[model samples]
Target: GGGGGGGGGGNTSHCAALTHIQDCLNLAFSTLDPISDRQNAPPAHTGYRVHIHMQRSFASNERTASSSSSSPSSYFVPTLSYWCFIPGMAFRRLSAYRLRSIILTSGTLSPLSTFARELYVPFPIRLENPHVIQNDQVWVGVVPVGPNGRRLCSKYDMRSDANYQDDLGNLVIHFSKTVPDGLLVFFPSYAVMAEIIDRWKTNAGSMASFAALRPSFSNSGDSNSHLSSLSTWDRISRNKFPVVEPRESSEFPAAIEEFRNRLGEGSKGNQERRDEGSNGPSSSSNGAVFFAVCRGKVSEGLDFSDRAGRAVIVTGIPFAMAKDSKVLLKKEVLDQEARTQQAQIVNCSNSNKGNNNSMSNSNNMSNSNNTNNNNNKNYHAGNHTHVTSPQPNSTSSSSSSSSS
Candidate 1:
């Protein structure tokens, strides 16, 4: 939503969860693109489901929230209490009329007249606004790369160019020369993550980068990796990232819980053991930066509050669209539903005449955006050279996920 265009599609996890939501609606999702279960299948419904990402340009203090039955199913609920963070400020402007109903649910919504002008909505709809709550607050942090650093390939697939300089080593060199003290190393696949750890995992050999692998507990318990051998997490607790915010699935949840217990209320568990007493380098030889391949479900949604995750190497475009095709279908179904709804609204508006301006219909943009992401964006297939050094004022470095 920045500088005008946001083609970044939803991730595997994001899309997957949205599918489950579709299932709840009892809406049969068929063909979808980027990675479709079927081809050329027409959309079935006018009302559809859509998903998008929240970038700095379109960060919202407002969102669309729905109420469900007290019973729970196989879906990821916000805070397990139906309370979730819905930042939809951008959408409200795009179709102020369509978004009016959604934004009215929030009293303290950042007033639309000003935003409407920025977005150029067709019609204006004002209603009683609900108070925007901020109780479930979390801290967000950012850190800069050290002098002379670079992006690497192993960050994409450790199994591919593992040694950092194996193939795309030049990318790492192109970016920065100095790896940080608390280095977080990310590998693409689990096998790749293991490959790198087996090679550079040790305290004696001057353990520079701390390798972050897929923690069993961090998973959604619905993955095939759930049944695999997982002895890597034990290593992380000893000298790894010192255990930050852990999800409900990790095996060491008890250990993490105990540490967070010591921290009193909310914590990154407890870094007391990993922390330097008031006057150390305030850093760690833990490499200089943390490294991890975006493997399993190690990093997503969860908060990395307080500390700075300085260098975040996405080790490849998270996961592939083909990894799960059902979401693509569900995504398509949502699109169809939305299109059908738009048609319905248009038909109704024509039928009801101008007397019902509230029956206005909006075009389908959310679907088209995601379809693009599911295809071209995830894995760039071009002459992508390796890079490093966060390009001065640049925070989002293009993660090199080019296929050989």
Candidate 2:
């Protein structure tokens, strides 16, 4: 198969489909055996360019149990998507026909130039509207180091470590105090979130420390209360003391109601202060804190406006795990493709500047290296400071909307 990682998993149907696609492609290629070679072709510079990308790394699919399927290991279907674009094709087709207007809109197409290229929209015009929220209302901050001054990272290897979890819990507690009302915390994945929560619950001291910050609720969708899940009933369990739990039935609704009340109360207080010519920020006591995983139900189509979503705290960069086999395969393929394209560009650029002296070429190469290094640094810095939107169709910033 072209992108063969999906074969190992327990998905027999997907494996068969992949095999069929590969066979069909092989037959088609055999028929076109005398096709012209475009090995040295310019990268989308002239005419049309067909780009193929493997979709297995980040594609969404259900995990099949090995016991229920033919394959022993669970694997994802490694599919290939092709983008064939010809410059000016849109204009040529439009000129050949009668058309009034062709307006395109998309929420995901933030960086318009990339979308334009992929869609072959030659000479495209783009416009964007301002985000809904104002700058001063939202705040975006980057906490590179934790309260202990250690690097705040959540990579697969370090995320499960005791020290890392402690630091993460400490950071969450610290942020909870500063952020008012309902503060939504988004984790990279559900597995990571569950691990951290389980560790804290198992450790009484850690649970006490975390509880002191705020009443943290999770969008786990598990209807059973945390205490109910316990098989044993001790004296402490019957004490009617409130405990933070990751379930809907366990104080989640009550927390939300309390948060709403606090919002109303806070608004009245702020109004009174403003009426008295005091421009100080108001504080509230009845608000709640919520924890959710990225791409979870709460993070997607939920409305967390006003007091429901005063702040959003992202634990770490939500990149895919590097240790996964699919991720490794994707990295290798992308790195190889990038190296080939970069080499072609470098060769073409150098050939175009053949008249330049050796010293000039060396200087140009040095400048390129420096630029690449700087770009890498900037990317790493930006990735660490990444934060999700607290509400749908809303953007966050401390000073300006673009600051986020």
Candidate 3:
């Protein structure tokens, strides 16, 4: 009986092992099938395209159980492997055909027509309501040139230029001095923010000199010339406490909390100054300036209303990298799809016009035949009447009839 029980346990273990192996085999086969067959598959109406990515990582751990004492071996390991069909496949799965309805709402859904086309879903009703805030509550402006009289361009090639970086820094400093309360400065990306901040730190002296200048000198005739000589760093620190967004997700909460604390302190200081009857501008009144990346944690899914964010300064347009694999692939797909749709529309229109022309030609031919038959009947009747009746002189009647 004990031997029988042991045999049963062994059989159960074998079955479990077989099941695990089967699952792994199924997963591997499924992944490979998609890669092999995706090309042969029909074009997805849901705007879905497969994206395959393989990430490699170097593993050099000396503490590994298999490592020898003499040498710490390093080897490249494939850390991640994934393939996905993206953009709207998931949403398409939950489309009106399957679900009762789909409603999309967002503040940033500009160019609604393009968005609807991409989703490949018919949005019969669309509303672009007025902003919730009154018109007077918001102010928008475009600054084409920097304080140093240089055109502000944040293109990839121009980003590394020392003069451009300095100009951008100076612009930020200028905003820090002018804008009250919390100032939100958004750079295109974290790399740009880091580069600009590094440049400012290196040229701290010129920034200090600029910050020391009185408000009256800011609007002087030589302000632009003076700005060309100056750089940026300590000006922001003197005017507004600087808070930077962190790259790591875990560090963001702390950064946000610090920003709030700084803003609160500035507000408190302003109240105290007002109580003392000093209405002049003070450093505390300048509040905190948050240096954040566009589309980062600070920019999206967060609110900084009222005193927390009195002004926002976007350094440049946050355009996607042209060389990015995903972006390039998506763009190519969209362009191809657009061309295909245009060709289809043209073909359909031409076919409809051809049918209409054929019908019109047939109808015109029938109408012309009817008109010719009526004219012939009238001519025959006139001749028959002339021959049958003779009341006046034949020549005179014939002449009158011809004249008539």
Give the per-residue lDDT of model 3 (tens digit) for 181-266. 88998989876787677777667445434434433325444454454454455556777888888766776887887787676534
By TM-score, is 2 or 3 better?
Answer: 3
Candidate 3: list runs displaced more than 4 Å. Answer: 1-42, 45-86, 208-231, 265-286, 346-404
Cα deviation of 227 in candidate 2 (Å)? 18
State each candidate's clash count: 49, 1, 0
Per-residue lDDT tens digits for candidate 1, residues 258-350, read 333333212432343335343222232232223333634345443433333334444455455454434565556557647865997898778
Instruction: Give the clash count for model 1.
Output: 49
Please report, in order, the local distance difference test score of every candidate based on alpha carbons: 0.36, 0.52, 0.67
The stretch of ten residues in a row with the least summed lDDT in candidate 3 is 63-72
| Candidate 1 wrongly placed segments (more than 4 Å) | 1-180, 187-192, 195-278, 281-310, 349-404
Ranking 1 against 3 by TM-score, winner: 3
Candidate 2: where is the Cα deviation over 4 Å? 1-108, 120-123, 130-132, 144-151, 174-178, 207-285, 321-404
Would you estimate the TM-scores of all the predictions?
0.31, 0.43, 0.60
| Model 2, position 352: C-alpha lDDT score | 68
- Write the residue-wise lDDT of candidate 2 on 1-404 in tens digits: 63575655547787888999998666444432211233543333232223444443321342211112221222455455422233333444454465665677755667877556534444356887778779987778888876655577877778888767765665665555555656677778755776665554444343333333323421133233442343211112221111222223343454444444444434565575576566543443435556666866566666788666777878876777667544565456446557866998999899767857776989999999986675444222442543332344765432222344
- By TM-score, the better pick of 1 and 2 is 2
Best by lDDT: 3
